[model samples]
Target chain A: MSAAPEATWVPRRYRVDAVRPELNDTVSLELAPAAGEAPAFEPGQFNMLYAFGIGEAAISLSGDPADRARLVHTVRAVGPVSRALAGLAVGASVGVRGPFGAGWPMSAARGRDLVLIAGGLGLAPLRPALLRVLADRAHYGRVAVLAGMRTPREVLFRAPLATWQGRTDLEVEVTVDRGDADWSGHVGVVTHLIPQLELDPRKATAFVCGPEVMMRHTAERLLTVGLEPTQLFVSMERNMKCAIGLCGHCQFGSAFVCKDGPVLRFDRIARALAVREL
Target chain B: MPERDAAEARLIEAPALQALIDALTARGYAVRGPRRRGDAIVFDEVARLEDMPRDCTTTQSPGRYRLADAPGAGYFGFSPGADSFKRWLHPPQQTEFRFRREGAAFVPIESAPAGVPRQAFLGIRACEIAAIGVLDRVFLEGPYPDPGYQHHRDGSFLVAVNCASPGRSCFCTSTGTGPRVERGFDLALTELHDSRHRFVVEVGSDRGAELVAQLPGRPAPAAAIAAARAVSARCAAAMPERFDRERVARRLRETPEHPRWAAIAERCLGCANCTTVCPTCFCTTMVDRTDLAGTTATRERHWDSCFTLGFSHLHGGSVRASTAARYRQWITHKLSAWLDQFGMLGCVGCGRCVTWCPAGIDLAAEAAAIGDEPGAPSGSDAHAP
Candidate 1:
């Protein structure tokens, strides 16, 4: 007899090994497959995380690509499905169907000066790429990480940021839109930090992730700083149901953000992004 | 090729159509054909030849559809209604998967009983046939194919019909998708409504030839062949080609900020009736439902439209929040971006969107207005975001 057909939408069970609250609304989950080891994923690939009786949401793999034992996702309590996923306790179960979409251009950026820019919760998708790059620190030249937050209180991965900041090999700069009493870092948008970086602009490759407006501004700023459009990448977010490209929810013009990207070269989508509401 | 020769240009009287239906039923196929449903003709199960609608045609225009009696015995006289083959194949709502909670882990449970009966679609129009081909490119040829769609489509048989009566909203001639069945069908029929009630059958597959062999028919005379060609030629004459595909696609790609979008949005209700009636609009959303005990949950995929506010929702809010933006996305995707994603154009010029739209918004007219000219920088007011 013929084998039963596979249902691509059905997700495998993953036990929540750990859950770390990043902020008032955001939480990071470490999930291990219920049966075997978690499937390996690339730096920028994402998973459709199902919250038990709740629906699924596309969350990027925020953990290290080198580690295959568990899949990490940082989710914010913004929508109904995300809220339920954020509140999951350790030992709870979540459905996962994933490792979908194109990954960051690590091979292309090899031996090139690396720059990473992120805004607000967009840092979650970029965290895995950073981790991969840091693991192989000798792969490239000068490296800089610029992050922007709404406020100091909303900064995610504080411990990791502090650890990376102390390293002499890396440059980590963070800014917030509003400063508080205890804050002493820059008090402006992330684009302001782009010009301050001292590097060979012609030799550097940058990856940006943030809100749409922030990404647009960051792309424009990087271009003005002598970085070519081909040397820059951006992670896009859209409403996704089936991350396999069957559902047309995450369409960004001709490209399906779930498949053709979550990580796309700036030059590939520059014209599409310029069109408002596309 | 032998089967093609055996069944090519066979002329069968109107009453002989029952033999084909009987042969399909004998092979455990559920024959679905058009029948009068209220004021419209819809595809429904027909156990006999008489069950299909006859001597009736539809009056279709922008935002209007009316069923009227035509002076003929043609069974496939009416143009398509709001209902398309999508309603049966993709379905408005379908169960994707079911899960049972076992302690801290959710285990996959068996879905509904399998063995979807083989379906034979009869009285399908040329435009509808092209729409099915478009869907095949989306669901079957993608990197990750949908099992549910494949299960429903695998054993299906299609019988295409040439439209002798073109409605006012019909423009298949423009898209080059219809008025006559070309390639993609198991069997094609051209109803000869002149002087006598007969059909010119062209077999497209082995199964179609086998079914035709069981029927009582004669080799089509020269007049029958000429008559069949005339049916399509007359349809093309009735409806002039609306817009040049390459020109409109290029124009749409260049002008996303056209002012015509905002003007069209003023009349568009964003009701999504156009997409609902569309044969190839294949956007869907997943809905999860659980029992009161919470032990089991079933996930269902429901038909969704790009026009819905929630279709483009993100964490903070929707991307295309304004109706104008949604309208631009839908039409631009259909006319231009679809070629970039899939090799073929998304629209087959079925014109159901024009007829079913509550606001009488004609997609062809809007596309021409926005896409016939060079790109203009329509200031900030034109940008919906």
Candidate 2:
């Protein structure tokens, strides 16, 4: 097979300036413009990050969009690429491609109560959107964030969580799949925390991300609590090779996850969701 | 009714035809013609006309094809090769975008680089021409035309040869494509042998007419036309039995929950060899490579297959996690759903799926098995024989 020429290639790059360990195997890297200006990307858009010789993986920007001086990507080590990404030190070189894919509809949720549900590392992408909503508190109604981690030790953004917990405008609840000896917070699945919240589901737009099973069950739970399918958005994950529509790898029925969304309404992909293997 | 003053052309002697290829190359066209490669005759750029396989023929079955030396010097030696017409159109990989870091911001860059040269493809069979039509409907006529594909297609010329020897795997006649060239070529050549050997050339395009005018030959007589028709008919007669694609599409669309899918899944490995060999399969993936400075990134488009496990992973889990589901998705999409989307049958009945399949899976048999059933026709086996 003849190699495709370079002119048609999409350039997706950002520069990494700092790295901080968050939890076991997970670290947060701060990025800035390596040379030119960083491409303006939406809150939910992800970038294809290349780890020198380790290969590429899609990572969502974890920092606020307005904070263009630096972009943050929080990643959990899983594959070779992610492992290499975790090992990079401060000022190490990491290639960035996109802030690709659709992000949370923050503008539409301005006056609506915001319910952010994140499971494990799924919290990484939702953090930026949550911060955006929290920053502009008067535009929205009740704001609640229900974050689920594997354990207390695995919880990410601990420092930010501390500050958000002190605020009266945001109701932050943390849960774990299982608990350790020192754990004192909610020790059940994240879904368990949803019932205790005193918010009107009709006025709420929930942004749920994390494990596929968790998101499905969470979306189901949100429906039971009266959130409309349209009012609920979920960040989807797939082996997204191209952030463009050309690659058929990330297709969910007729939609390309990399293009149409990494974030989609529950109603949009319900049928594909029900299928056993896709 | 034929136009009175329509330009007419006749075939040159075999030696003279070789000379024409040499002359064309001397004028700067990259000449890609049929030549013996390994076990098959494939199209490749050649420096001289002598590279054309002059004495080769292929035996084709519903799911098998093998090239062999012909009884004598037969110019139209074999059926189409394993490579599809899409190879020249939608190349396996392309760059859709590029980026360079200027200071701290990444800038989006897009351009179409020129490398593929203008060339003439010789001995393109009628079935191959039909395959090109299917691809044109996909890439060129789509809402977004592939710039790279359009560039190569516009630059290339075609010389279609009427099939005088049908392979066992060929069912082009049933697909309404060939045994003869009705359209979609610059020049259509029909090999004729009587007192002497020559190719009766019919110019289908203005380019073909101009080229024919330059050849050292005369307009063919009425007898030569009859011989060409007879040869085409003989090839058509040898086509393997084909299926009704319309009926197959209808049957498949009517029955999405069919038992045949599970049965086929039992045998399918989900390797996606069929799609890879298919002339019109156009799925791709993108990847980004950043420079050492991490300031610039180059995103690349690569060919991807649907059979892989990770193709349909969402936040919760994979939608099509089972081998059976993937196989069903591929078949249903190709025969039934594709018709709804593209307004044409996805398969051209080339039988490459049957011949190239590692497990020797026969698409015709599978389609027949499903289409024969009454439970809403689960798997539409509509294929042109």
Candidate 3:
């Protein structure tokens, strides 16, 4: 493939305007386009963030889509590329490839009660949808946010969560999977928080992002609570090499997690997800 | 004389094959045909017909391959090698782009999907042609067409050969891909070496007609057409229908926890050799490299296999950790999921995997094992190869 004839694979340069260290090994990077208009994207959409001398990883857009000047991505240093991306300094140049994949259902969920659930770093992708929902608050009914952190110290977007908690218009609940001596909050898996939620389950649109097993379990729990399987939406993650869907690394059976969805209705992917190792 | 509108056969002596090579070369086309590389037949650059394998025939079975000298036989008498057109069109390692540090930002400069060879691929088999067609559907017909695949594919020419002899592991007849090509060729030929060594040439595209018109040949009489059809028909009958692909795909898709997967796990090494050698497999993994000074970095795409543990890695670890699950994913994707994605079977019935597998794992047998009862003589032990 030495033949460099196409621009699809070439990453556009984006400067790191700001960096905020979050919970252990995670950082939120705020990027501004070094050239051209900032790419337009929706909630739950992601881009292939390329670190020079490393490689590329699919990172979701955590910043407000309305904010055209800045692009934000919250990343955890799990892999080599992610590690390099997390360690990048402000003003450092990074290659950015896309604003690809399906986003959360904002227009579709209008007039319906919404449940936004996140576990650990899964909050990054859902942050956009949360912003969109808050903006169009009058269009929807009760917005319930149930976020689960590994511990109180592991909570991402601490200031935003605290701000969300102050708003009486929405119900924001935070739990921890693990706790420290200073921690005095609910301690359990995210699924445990679902049963305690009191919403119009019949009209609620559930958006979940977390470990696949966690989503699977939470969806089952949501189903038990009266939300239709089709009403539940999931933001799925897989080993993606090409965010455009050609690489075949992000295939979830017939659906390409890169293109067909990073955001998909739970019913469509339930069967494929259950097939172990698929 | 009969109306010769493309399918009309033009006879060329086996020794005069060099004329065909010269014909392509004259048109600024690099002639890449099958030849001997070590012990296997591989596609390589050919200046003359002498470079093609003539006095050599190959034997292929599960986990075994042998090429012996067979004096005075026709050339191109073997199944495909590990390398398919993917090696040339997609490439193993390609520079996606070169990046240079521009102050605070890194600039990814252009250099991809360019310099694609303007090539005439000679001796492409019927199955290989179908594999190319399938790849076209994936790289071109998909939502985001791969620029690298489009540039190389659109510029290349194909010279397909109908298989006069089917290999031991071949099941093309079963898959309906074929011993005879009906589409996607510039020039299609059926080699006949019975009483006299000759090629029954059928001009396919406008380009094929031009090449044939330049050659010395008489209008092929009815007898020549009948003989050519007979050769392809014989080959079709020789290759057995190893699997019911229509039913197998559906069955494999429905049944995920079949005991057959656990059984095959005993023999499967997850070496990913099958995927690498497959004609239709097109997965790619990318890597980035920086120079010693770390000033410039280049993103490179490499041929990736699903068998790698890292291929399925997420935050904690890989989604597919077990060998049985990985094997199931490979076969199920090839047979069933591919149908759901591309509306076609991923396998073109090439037997390269069976011949190259280190543990003698035949896919046909695995196909039979799956979608069958728990124990009903799957033919996995029959040694169809």
Compared with the true structure, what per-residue lDDT tens digits does model 3 show for residues B111-155? 433565588899999999989988988888876788778777765
In model 3 chain B, where is the ten-residue run with the lowest total lDDT?
B376-385
Best by DockQ: 1
**Candidate 3 residue pairs that clash:** A1-B94, A3-B112, A3-B113, A4-B111, A4-B112, A5-B112, A5-B113, A5-B114
Stretch of 10 with least lDDT, candidate 1 chain B: B376-385
- lDDT string, candidate 2, A1-278, tens digits: 12233322333345568888898888998877667667677778898777653467889988887786777889888877789888877656666767677899999999999989999888888988987886788999999999998888888888998899999888999988889999889898999888788658789999999887799889888888888999999988877665655455665554567877899988877645644454
- The Cα error of candidate 1 at residue A70, in Å, is 0.5
**lDDT tens string, model 2, B1-385?**
1222223646566666776676566656687777788888776776676777777788765446788887664777677677755666777776555556564334565554756777777778887777777777666674345566677786577788888867666666555677787777877788876778788887777767778777888887777877888889998887765666666666665655667777777778788888888776777765557778776566556667777776665444566777767776676666666666567766766767777777777776777666777643222232110
Docking class of 3: acceptable
Against the true structure, what is each candidate's TM-score?
A: 0.97, 0.79, 0.94
Q: Which residue runs does candidate 3 get wrong by more than 4 Å?
A: A1-6, A180-184, B1-7, B109-114, B374-385
Model 1 CA deviation exceeding 4 Å by range: A1-7, B1-7, B378-382
- Model 1 agreement with the true structure over B238-335: per-residue lDDT tens digits: 99887888888887777777778778889999999988898999999999999999999999999999999999988778888889899988988888
Return whichever of 1 and 3 wins on lDDT.
Answer: 1
* N/CA/C clash count, model 3: 8
Best by lDDT: 1
lDDT string for model 1 (A174-213, tens) is 9999999999999999999999996578899999998988
